[model samples]
Structures are given as structure tokens and as C-alpha cells.
Target: MTAVETPELDAALAAAEARCARQGATLTPLRRQVLRLVLEAGQPVGAYTLLERLKERRGPAAPPTVYRALDFLLEQGLIHRLERLNAFLPCIGPEEEPCGHGCGHDHPHQFLICTRCGATAEIADHDVAHALTAAADRLGFRPSRATVEVEGICARCA
Candidate 1:
């Protein structure tokens, strides 16, 4: 089976290339391969799964190689890591633009993970972020980064 359908994959790759150029970073071939695997996964995927897929296509891949690529992708804001799931998901922002929330990296986003189907929806709610920030400030805590993951059945599953 094809890992990803053609048109969407092509667009995503192109957009990634452009984003990298704008940020003065290079998305090398290896990194592109890793990104493709993540996008085609259609759900959060673990690092080992990515490595396994890479090994299937290439002869053998080192764990560090896969981890390095994942690091680069995360740094470029091209993907998100779901800490709870210990997996990665492609960022759901517009192909060529940031979410405009000024979240700095990966677009201050949250996930609605369906407990039953394991499907996830990415949402950026400024109010929620603001409220969290306000609460943190009240406690004299400074948050360098924030990720809010709400676990429940999505509309389809519900």
C-alpha cells in the first residue's frame, strides 16, 4: 500500500522545503524520508515505528539517525510530540503558514485525542492558553512551553 497519497504528500513536502529555506535550515533527504513516514502514518507514531519503516525501505537504519531526524523535524515545527502517547504527529497548521498564535514553536496547540479510535484533532484556543498562563503567573510559575492534551472521544467516536 502507498504510504501517502500523491498530491497531498507532494504539497506537504514542498511547503516543508519552503519553510526550511525561510528559516535557513535544510531539510535533508533523510529528514524528508522521516517526515513522510510521520505524515503517512495518519496517527501518532513512535520513533521505533519510524525506524522500522526506514529499515524496511533502506537496508538498516541506526536509532540515533532516526532520533536526529525527529529532532530536526521537531525543531522546525514540522511535527509535534505527544508526551502522553510517546509518539509524534505532523503539525496540523497550514502548509505554508504558522497558526498565527505566536506560540513560537509548533503553534501553541492542544490535542483532542479520541480514547476509542485514537484519532486526534489539533486545536489552538488562545483563551485556554491565556487562562493557563494567568493561572501559572498567579502561582509565580513561568512556563517556557505548554501543551494541553485533553483525552476524550471525538465527535465520530462519541
Candidate 2:
């Protein structure tokens, strides 16, 4: 199936290419292949699944290679680590735009994840951000990063 080309993905790919060039990392063909798979999948993809795709493309590959690529991608902020699912999905936001840290984005996005199908949708609403900040202020909890992921059945699944 053909993959949907969102504006976010286009921007992300361009940003990643620029970042790799600046860092002197080639973002080698294999790494690019794997990354494309993750991006095209449109859901959190497990390491083993990545390995399988890699093997299909290049004959044979070790698990460590896939893991290492994933690590590098995560480190570079090309993707985000989904803690709950223990899988990787491409970052849908602007490239090199830092969130959940000292980055200066007014509203960080939250993920609406579908447990059944692994579909993830981004929610970026001001009301939610305001409420979260207000609640955190009450508790005196300073949030460095604001990531609000709600995991449950999506409309289709429900």
C-alpha cells in the first residue's frame, strides 16, 4: 500500500537529512531503509518487526544492528520512544524541535493511541495544555516536558 505523505513527515525527513549531514553521519542506506519502514508503518513498530523488514530488503541482518539504528534515531530526536508500548514510532512533529525538555514549544502534543490496532493520533489543543499546566501548578510540579498520551480503544476499535 502507498503511504500517506503528511506535511509533518516531509518536514521531518528534510530535517533529518540536514541533521545527519551536520553530524557527519551518512544515515546510511540501510538505516534510511529501516527508518522509512517505521515511518510508513504509521504505528509503533517493534524491533523484531523492523529486523524482519531489514532482512527482507538486504538478505540477512543481526538484531543488534536494528537496535543500534533505533538507538541512534532516538538519540537524534528523529523518533520518540513510546514507553508504554515498548516500540518505536517516527516523530510526527517538526524536525529538531525539542519537547518535554527546555524546548520552547507552547503546547506539546499528546498521543491518542489505539490499543487494539496500534494507531496513534496527535492531539494538540490549547485547552488541554492549559488544564495540565494549571493542575501541575496546583501540585507545584514543574513539568519540563509535556507529553500526554491516552491509551485506549479508538472509535473504530470501540
Candidate 3:
């Protein structure tokens, strides 16, 4: 199950809301609901799943509506889109990243994905970032995006 009732979750929401306010962005009720679902999911959640859940309460909502909310959440650094699963997960990190894209997508981070339970964690470390950059340098590559996902079992699942 997703982290249903935790202090960290509460803090995340509060921080997100505050950040949105600071930037003159609206974390609308609908967007907030979507963020909650993704966070409580305890794993990556697909757009379809989010749409399904929204329909249960709101009735006959369109995919674009959810996507728009998702995009807003992503821009505010409240959630992230998992590249591998094409799913969304909460941004559980402590600080904000530069917003060249006005979204956390520019943030260099790594994901530890639990293949067994589907639980995911986010990590932002300098060493790992350097290693990625160094490897890319070997090929004279300029990295644009740097979100990484590794599939394995988390300690809880293991």
C-alpha cells in the first residue's frame, strides 16, 4: 500500500502548496487530489489509473484533464514521471532544483525501483551525478535529461 498517513506525506503536500503559492501557481483541488493519489500509491501510477480514480469521484473526466494536472504537479516539483513505466511518482526529495524548464525534470536524480513490490525511491547524489557526467564525457556527450531508474528489490520487499 502507499504511505497512507505519514508526516512526510503531509510535509510534502504543504511544501508543494507553499512553493506553488510563491511562484503564483495554482495547485487546484483536482491537481492536489491527483498528487495525493500518486503519493499514496506507494509506487508509480499510470495516467490511466489516475483517470480511473478521478472518474470514481468526479465522473466522466477526460485524460487531458489529468494530464494537465500531472504536468502542473511535475512543474511544481511535486511529482515526477517515471520514464521506464510511463508512470507518475511523488518527489520525496528535500529541496528544489533549478527550473530551466520550470519543472523538476531538469533535476538530476536517480530512481531505485523495486521490481518485486513496485515501490520506488528517489536519490540525488553528487558522486552518482559525476559518474554519469564522466561516462558521458568519455563519448563527448552533452546530457539534457538525467533521470535514471534501476530495477531491484527494496529492503522492505527483500
Candidate 4:
């Protein structure tokens, strides 16, 4: 993976650390590093891809180590797993409000995935969420969570 060091990443890291502290979760060095990799990727990145990147920097990193870090990130809501792609994307850290990208730590996760370029964008649509909830409630079903993924060509590709 290409290296990324930017003010945005630094700010994100700081916010993530602060958020973890507030939640009583320890964002250890390894976990922080993993989060950095995810954020730098700027797209859905698979676990194995992350592992390879780690290996390039750390000499040798076991799969379990990477997996554990990923689990911690997910639990802390610092990153999200794209189920369809089996990949991960960093959460829009608390530094930004109103969930401009729809991947805020507390916002609903809906993704528009570009099948051609593999780019993905998170979107927030309250109407869609409300409609889905209403439809489910009519059937007496209560959903603990929901993720919507739409695959198509992105505007850039089009």
C-alpha cells in the first residue's frame, strides 16, 4: 500500500484516540497502526491486503494479530466492515459532524460501490432507513441493525 501522511490523517488519529479514551477503550499501538492503514487506503481494503502492508513495515505480522486489531477497531466503531467485499473502511471520525460521508461512528451505513473502479461512497438517507424500518415493523420484525449496499458504476467511471 502507498504511504499516506497528511494533516487529515493526523487529525483523524488524534480524534480516534480521544474517542477511544472517552469510551474506556485502549487504542493500542497495533490497533492505531491498523486504523491508520485503513484510513490511508481511502477505499475498502481487505484484511489480507492490510496484513501484507503491515508485513512490509514490521518484518512479520501474523494473521491473528491483524484480525485481532480489526476486531478491536470494529468493536470501537473506528472502522466498518463491508460485508459484500469482505473489506474495511475507516469511520468518519468524530472530528467531522453530521456524517457528510454517512460513515460516522453513530450514523447508519449505506454504501454506493463502484463495480468498475472498486471505489465506494457512504451515503445517509433517513427516508430509506425509515421506510425499511416501517416495512419491517408491519411484519412485526424488529431489526437490531441494517446495512444497505448498492453496486454500480460511479460517476467517474460513467
**Candidate 2 segments exceeding 4 Å error:** 5-14, 92-107, 124-146
Clashing pairs counted in every model: 0, 1, 0, 0
lDDT string, candidate 1, 11-56, tens digits? 7777777777889999999999998898899888999999999999
**C-alpha RMSD of candidate 4:** 2.8
The candidates, ranked best first by lDDT, are 4, 1, 3, 2
Question: What C-alpha lDDT do the candidate models reach, one value each?
Answer: 0.80, 0.71, 0.77, 0.81
Tens digits of per-residue lDDT, candidate 2, 48-101, equal 998998899888999999999998777665666677777777753445543323
The candidate 2 region of ten consecutive residues with least summed lDDT is 98-107
**lDDT assessment of candidate 1:** 0.80
1 versus 4: better lDDT goes to: 4
| TM-score of each model, in listed order | 0.90, 0.68, 0.81, 0.90
User: What are the runs in model 3 whose C-alpha is more than 4 Å off?
Assistant: 4-10, 92-107
Q: Tell how far residue 148 is off in model 3, in angstroms.
A: 1.0
Error of 4 at 66 (Å): 1.0
lDDT of 4 at 69: 97
Residue 79 local lDDT, model 1: 82
- Predicted model with the maximum lDDT: 4
